[model samples]
Target: MDIELYHDSKYGNGARVAEEFKRLAETKGSNVNIHHVREAGSKNLPRADLYVFGSPTHFGKATRGIMRFVKKLELPPGTKYAVFGTFSGAAPDKKTGKMPSEEELEKRRRTIPMIDEALRSKEMAKVAEMRFFVKPENLKGPLEDGWQKIVEEFVVAILGK
Candidate 1:
């Protein structure tokens, strides 16, 4: 399988996750190419068995660069794709000192959905979607522990090996 992975990483956390995904997919004998959105510029995206897009969450949505890239993608309809996002999950409530529930966080973070919407508009088929959390205290993260394992799972799911 051939895969093209594009990412918009302001602080490099998303890039790190994309690299891990690429490494895992390559181990399964799939060819994976990684590119930054700026480098790719949404033109003539190489054909691949699957396309994976990653973005860092900004104000609960995908960064402007990624949104623009996705909107400009010209891939044929019914193309296969997956998406992932890196976010600093909600911090503890100031009053209660308790972290927000996952349900609440899901409602607040729409990064993956934003990307998925653009892809769906172009009639692409989604294989999977995931979110990797950044440490709440450090938005430019050391990702939440075990993020590599999540990437491994994603690689297996998309590559089917």
Candidate 2:
């Protein structure tokens, strides 16, 4: 399958994960292309059997650039797509030393739904979704431990292997 991963990264976390996804997809014998959202203009997106999107979670949603890209995206009806987000997990508040509540954590990981909605507007079929939490200490991350397994699972699911 021809796969394209278009991503926006802040602090490199999103790009890091996107690269891993690309590597994994390639290993599975699928032809995959990776593009930074800025580099892949909406008018010039390459043809692909599957479209993947990645972005760092910002203010509980995909970045404005990604949203705008999706809004202007031109894809055929029923195009297969997937979304991934690099999110910051809750850390203890400096003042109270308390972590965010479960609801807050869920809200903060809202990037997936927002991206999915945008893809849906283009009449795309979402095939997969993933959220890789970043380590809070450095802010920038090599994702949390066990990320390899997550990526592996995503590859399998997307490829239907």
Candidate 3:
């Protein structure tokens, strides 16, 4: 399957994670394209069997650029999708003994439902499935080591890898 990961990161985390997603997406020998939303011109998103949108969460929602782009986009019939995002903050400390893995941390780096909720609210019922990720500050990455597994597994299922 062909995939395109279009993302916007005023904070650059979206693009960073998108790159990693691109790498994982291609591992299965599928054709995957990654684009930065900042450099995207117009809503003319690419043709892909699947779309993975990554954006920096804003006020617990997807970024304005992503929202505008999605608003203007009409997926080719039969398109499937997933979403990911990045944020800068410390989540409420959980008292659990298990520390969330790096990717899980990134997945929770920010809440993505704001964007997902808005998508449904805007009548985006075609999204076959949805998943999200969050990352921390300027360091190794929210995608550290274990994080890739979250998205990689999602891709394997979507693409049947």
Worst 10 residues of 1 by lDDT: 152-161
* Each model's Cα RMSD: 1.3, 1.3, 5.5
Question: Candidate 2: misplaced stretches above 4 Å?
Answer: none
Instruction: For candidate 3, report its TM-score.
Output: 0.67
Ranking by lDDT: 1, 2, 3
**What's each prediction's TM-score?**
0.94, 0.93, 0.67
Residue 148's lDDT in candidate 1: 91
Candidate 1: global Cα-lDDT? Answer: 0.89
Lowest summed lDDT across 10 adjacent residues in model 3 is found at 132-141
Which residue pairs in candidate 3 have backbone atoms (N, alpha carbon, C) closer than 3 angstroms, thus clashing? 103-147, 106-134, 106-135, 107-133, 107-134, 109-134
Worst 10 residues of 2 by lDDT: 134-143
Model 1, 1-161: lDDT tens per residue? Answer: 99999999998899999888878888889999999998887888888989999999887789999999999999999999999989885799879999899898887688999999999899999998888998888878889999998888788778777
Give the best candidate by TM-score: 1
Q: How close to the true structure is residue 144 of candidate 3, measured as C-alpha lDDT?
A: 38
Candidate 1 accuracy as TM-score: 0.94
User: 31, model 2: CA deviation in Å?
Assistant: 0.9
Which numbered prediction scores highest in lDDT against the true structure?
Answer: 1
